[model samples]
Target: MRGLDDHTYRKRTAALKAKRHDCWLCGDPIDYTLPWKHKMAFTADHIQPRSKGGHIYGEIRAAHRSCNSSRSNRVTTVTTAPKTALRW
Candidate 1:
């Protein structure tokens, strides 16, 4: 399959950066850098895996390489519990 050229990738990356200011998964700040910089490597992750009917460029989140890898294909959610008194 054909992949996006460097120019097209840059444009798309810039637009996505403008829309979301941080890593969508962990809420970490995104570092904008030159293409050659080591920190420039970022992954576009699917909020829901493609195997589960997710589409390319559909519901994506930008994340650091490590964070993206660690979060691979898992559904994340935040839950709250009622407060209870504790006994010593």
Candidate 2:
């Protein structure tokens, strides 16, 4: 996988955090103050998976560290199931 260097990663994270974007994966707020290893910590995720031949400097979106790691190079689509009510 094409991983980012420490400087690039931190730079990207800071930029995203400054924008106050929600995690594109799980739609949760990123805790930029948290340590890098924290589950809620901010991370930059590739718009396309690197394992699928995505470019190293391609578009990226903000994500939580755990959410990004859980994706694990798989293509993901986040959707919440619609709520249904029973009719008597």
Cα lDDT tens digits, model 2, 1-88, are 2345656766765786789777888776677789988988888898788889876666788889898999989877658742235654
Model 1, 1-88: lDDT tens digits are 1366555555666676666456666666667553423443466666787767765555665666567778767775525432235754
What number of clashing residue pairs does each candidate have, in the order they appear? 0, 0
lDDT of 1: 0.60
Provide the overall lDDT of each model, using Cα atoms, as 2-decimal numbers: 0.60, 0.78
User: Which window of ten consecutive residues has the lowest lDDT sum in model 1?
Assistant: 76-85
Q: In model 2, what is the error at residue 86, expressed in angstroms?
A: 30
**Model 2: ten consecutive residues of lowest lDDT:** 79-88
lDDT of 2 at 45: 90
What local lDDT does model 2 show for residue 3? 42
Q: Check candidate 2 and list the clashing pairs.
A: none
